[model samples]
Target: MRKAIIITLVVLISSFVMAQKPLFKVDTLSIELSDLSLHAVLTKPSNIDNPPVALIIAGSGPTDLNGNQPMMQNNSLKYLSDALVENQIATLRFDKRGIGKSVYPAFSEADLTIDRYAKDVRSIIEYLKEKQFANIYVIGHSEGSLIGLIALQDISVEGFVSVAGAGNSADVILKKQLKPKLSAEYFESVEIILDSLKNGHVVKNVPPQLNALFRASVQPYLISWFKYNPAELIKKINAPVLVVQGTKDIQVDDEEAQLLAGACNNCSLAEIENMNHILKTIEGGMQENIQSYSKPSLEINKVLVDTITAFIKNYSK
Candidate 1:
């Protein structure tokens, strides 16, 4: 009986030790940006000598640092951050202004223009500069790419990575995405809506059918967003750029990726076959493609990681 008790205690102690093991230690910080407190998570390597850090900017909408969409329950960013930590890379991710632990008077989506977002990035960069990291790189995904690009005008980052970024204006991309999703009869109506926005016209009382496309709060944002072309912006960026596009990405096609690459004087493009917009490998039909978004078991393509790791490793040295 004494031997049995001892064995049980040993197992419990071992379990406790394993549970206490640190996979990674992340620091949660509140940064003051534009008179508001922006929440950021900074994860560092366990042991390193002046390691380079990557700042991860989440995509459009109310995406948190963990890459979770407010409307959805996906946690893709968390997985990506964990993977990066395992690779001995440090990362910083944060919530956008007025979203998730961020203080705001609730700015309308219309007020959430790219310039405003860029200001937020600038604030974060300034904060990072104080930390004295060896190198600072911005890794922007989707709409965040535009924010990062605009921020570059103010902050001096070592390099940038655009993941599934759009090459054209948001208006043009929205129109293209809506055409196939909407019926032929509704195409003209959608075009009219986009035209009104392009002309900087305030559209009140949007049509019931168009509510999904244009929210009352997001109208002004769409108006501001439609003005900038990513490809043009990419051309203006003097820093080394890396564009990663998944071949199976339905939201942004390979053509857009190519356009971004072509615009940048110093840029490298990595096309990951069968990888979806979220970086998961998808097989079968369109339904199957989206299903990967919910599957946490689905890992991002190793090629994507290898490409990014190699680029950062070469550049950091």
Candidate 2:
């Protein structure tokens, strides 16, 4: 009866999967800010009413609401959203102005600034407050962490979560990220451009090889971003803070998370080992860790979901 036993086992597995089916619904929403519209997706558990919502903010670059770029399809934020919703928490993730479906003709790259993104975050919070949710939480990844902190200054949120956020200022992180990738001559020249930008002056002539980075058009935004330090800003937040850092995160060191945790008395640091910048666990070497960026099929680390869910649930009213 070996064949009969195999069929019974398959039937049992299918039944178990059906029992754990998803119970969530997703809908598109948008908010208007200064004549520009930012689009977002709200994923709410079908079984929970007026559930506490989490605002998921993406990291740097043209990262879409799903935590993805034009070429990279890894659904880091999307999967995070699904996991949170499964735990009965609603999630709201949006596209910044001029990115993805949030693109606007009036939005110009030259007009962009870090404050612009922070303003969007504030506007979204107001929108959510009007919706009368049970409570609201802010979860920012990478640069979004600083933007969220900036937004939280004037508004009251349930709590805030920092995932792979930089502890130092923008200029400091830029220099560290670029030192290994640039030649000595170019590296020193890059520092000169950064110094000028830090002083609020635009460098007219950036090295041709580094034009993509130090271009004149992008300098204003850099100047605005480099002004705030995450460690300094986190001190001003009145709400509870949770800093999540991965040991394998090449972009941001685990030590950075400690700085953030150390700055805020109420902040708690969650140090996860073998987890990378994209929130995936490392099973092999550098190639596998880097490859996780493009692998959408691979699931995110389970420990991350548990940590976030427990934190939010503990604070939910």
Candidate 3:
């Protein structure tokens, strides 16, 4: 009986050790914004003397803090947060106003502008400040990068990290990315739709054939997004910036990274080979690249993590 008890205790202790434990505990907070209650996830470091914090902003679509879209169920940001926490970095990630557990009163794409997201970011920054956080960083992905740039105009962040961020306007990016995948005839049609948007025309009746190409939910956000150029914004930012891009990213190309790098007075770009838009290493063709988005088994490259950690640590000093 004593042997059995010893064996059970050993197993219990081993289980505790083997279990995946978060380096930090995630705290959820609700902040009142206009007529909505915004929800944010604050990951507090386990052992630190009030370490600097970072606010993580998700990309386009209905992406949550965990980097999971409604259609794409894999949670990449969860792993990212875990990785960051392992490095003793506290992070805050949140859902957009109308998504996930966040409050929504029929919020539409028209209401989703860079300004609105900036406002939300400002609110979160204020909340962090109230918590006595001395230094705050902003890490933005894709569309969130634009929002982060806009947020800088209002809030004072210690530093900024742009992950897979575009250096051009949304319209330019859309045309460049989508045109190659579609037929030349269909591509011209897309240009016409974009031209209409550029002229500030509300598209009420998209042709039935273009339904997949032009989503109603994406239109208004696109309209609001068309007003800003990321390169221009990058130039105006006074804080030290890190531009992390993947060479294999199909959405935002190297040219975009170059444009951003050229515009920034105090910015450095780290290009990760074989890494895709979602920060997963892609080894195959187009289909394989898209498949990586849903594959959580694919881990973010170690070099990328090391680079970021080293950069942050060196810059923090």
Candidate 4:
């Protein structure tokens, strides 16, 4: 009985150790901009050599590499990376300048422009190329979609995926979101400010209610963003494009994906049912969709994973 118990304990310990081992090799690397050193994680399948690599850019705000901000907590991007690894695809996710461990103290929001973000992505692409990653792709979510679209433009990439990206320019989307909430006077003020910014000018007389969104500190960055029209940019992409949108997304709708598909010569659109802005399957109403943003345990809608992986594999083959 004692010998049998010892053998069972040994077997269980061995199994635990094996299970503790990571399924893929992860490297926490840094990419240096002029003054900022951006932090990133590269996850690759342990068994595959020269596997397809994706540059996963997070959405708007201070969303980190794992798709979470300081007050927000979610494992959407991390789970997506795991899903990709299972499908034999590798991913490199990073914290953009002035976010997470890559924070730049000297840089203000004005320093954060669309061009700066694109250049950072370009640097990462160069790094991946140096490592000899043959199949390289860009996967941008929400605002990252615009960033990815601009970055991929002048760079050599296998394909591009826009996840929950906006179809219209920043001004148009802002008008849509604020129309129902703001008074006519306030809405007109916003329109005027947006138009001025779009036309290479900034408005100093900003409404107090709109200060948070159009703060002076972020106006320059907003101006830079306002210059790119998602639909127009999609038309310019030479590489294959995959636009994914969730039907239940409160922030962005399926029409955005459709616009992208219509504009791109080589584009595939996937409208995932019941998925929200954060890419989790909907369970209830708006509250449930918001709750999913904090639920780190919830897996991203499997259809998203399957759709993306299949797209990558199709081209790879």
Candidate 5:
């Protein structure tokens, strides 16, 4: 009876201790921008008192806080947040204005400039600052890298990470992406449209097939996006920067990472092998790589995460 009582007491005590241990928590947050409200997901370690925090900016074109677009759903950013929490770090990932929960009908499409995106990030960084997070970092994936770099100009942070960001200007990147798929004549038309937009003029003669990418509605935004070169902007950042690229990424290549690393005086580069644009490890052709965009089940490349973790930890030290 005494032995059994002792065992029961131990089990109860163990259960109590386990219950006392806190798990990571998530909170749905919002920041107001004039008439619109930007939606965000804040993830943090439950036991951490003043954990280092990262502002995770998603890529372009309607990517949500979880890094999903309308046609595809993937938890790339969500997985990244969880990984950060596992390392006792806090993170805030948000939807860009006019994307996901931030899409308000009252907002004009013309307001979608890279500057606006940078301002939104700055707003969040200011909020985290108010919350007393001593160490703040920014991680931008794809187009978010450009936005984050721009944001760094206005708001200071400990470090910045660019994942699969294009080093060239938007016009140059677009031309490269269209070269293989477009006919010679159609390619000329693309050049004309891009040139007009580069000169701050909108063209109404958009080809039917190209309307989705270079439509009149998006021209103003494109004009704004075209003015900034990622390489040039990255050179202006004073904070430590990490340029991360995947070897198998179909959207971006190693050259972009190299260019970015070369531009920044304080920068480190990490190229993950077999990792695609969505940060998944896929050792296959283009079809298999593209298919990974919607596969949320696959985790981000561990090397990518480890590289970021080590970079931040070392910088903090």
Candidate 6:
């Protein structure tokens, strides 16, 4: 089944690879917000000074700096950072304000919104700016792609890359992913709640069974999220855009990438064959595909790394 559209309730288990005299130097960096700080892991080629850097925004959920969610320790983002650094570029992966090591004494999920997430990205960008990187790019995976689009509106970057990101708004995508499994009545409720959220309203009459997906506490976040449409937002970006999709991805389809590419100016579309949502290569049924999500030892698709490396290096300063 396709994944549902909801805040990911993730576990935090991180995995790391050890290498002596590693070509890259990894550091824990952070940026301060009003009452909290956001943390990130920066991996840069040790031999290069102020190399071009990519702010790698992870997908939704409790995903940490290593792209891991509790039981699933695939380290998807970590591998991406490793690959880029191996090719002489730097990458930074951050944990959201309340996730991973970004803890606030008064952290509240009720206070979270898509705009808030974008602001976090902006904060990280400002921090990166002071570091004197030669150039910078923003890469967002899954939900992070939309967050990147919203954040890029206020900041200028060398380029942007969207991986496994949805092309439509949260409301539209959610309705589609859920309609197949829900009963007729449940599906109707889904539509009603989504429509109300899209209109910037809170839904209080959520069915008891559907409360988990539309609980009162998360409605504000949903209200802010439903307002964004990726296709519409992509049109406003001034930087070069790369829309990446994978053939084996069960979460997002290829048409979504095409929707983004079609709307973006100075955009390039890369449809990677046999690549899954987590950016790993897969060649099997649903069971085999899902198993790959937990395999931290498995490397991500090489073409994905090469494609991004070439794209970022093309505009290297």
Which candidate number has the best lDDT? 2
For model 4, name the residue pairs that clash: none
As a whole number from 0 to 100, the lDDT of residue 280 in candidate 4 is: 92
Give the top-scoring candidate (TM-score): 5
Q: Distance (Å) between predicted and true CA of 49, model 3? A: 1.8
TM-score of each: 0.90, 0.93, 0.89, 0.93, 0.95, 0.92
Instruction: Summing lDDT over every window of 10 consecutive residues in candidate 2, give the lowest-scoring window.
Output: 29-38
Could you give me the TM-score of model 2 versus the true structure?
Answer: 0.93
lDDT of 6: 0.89
lDDT (10s digit) by residue, model 6, range 1-317: 12332223221111122334468798987677877878888888998787899999989878887889987899999999999999999999999878889978898888889899999899888888978775999999999999999999989999999999998898888888899989998798789889998999888788898888899988999999989999999998988999999999998888889998999778999999999999999988798789999999999999999999999999877
lDDT of 2 by residue, 181-256 (tens): 9899879998998888888898887778889998877888999998898999999998899999988898998778
Per-residue CA lDDT of candidate 3, range 18-107, in tens? 675546787887877777888888887777877778788999878998888877865677767777777878888898788787848778
Write down the lDDT of every candidate, Cα atoms only: 0.83, 0.91, 0.82, 0.89, 0.87, 0.89
Residue 259 of model 2 has an lDDT of 84
| Native-structure RMSD, model 6 | 12.1
Off by over 4 Å in 2: 1-22
125-184 in candidate 4: lDDT tens per residue? Answer: 999999988889999999999999888778878899999999899778888888888899
The global Cα lDDT (0 to 1) of model 5 is 0.87
Q: In candidate 5, what are the lDDT values of residues 1-317, reduced to their tens digit?
A: 99999999999999999998877888998887766788988888998688888899999888899989888987998888888888888889998888888888887886578888888889889999998889999999999999998888867899999999989888988888888998999899999999889888889878898898887778888998888889998888878999999999888878888988888788888889998888888978888888888888988888888888888777763
Which residue pairs of candidate 2 clash? none
Q: Could you tell me which residue pairs clash in candidate 3?
A: none
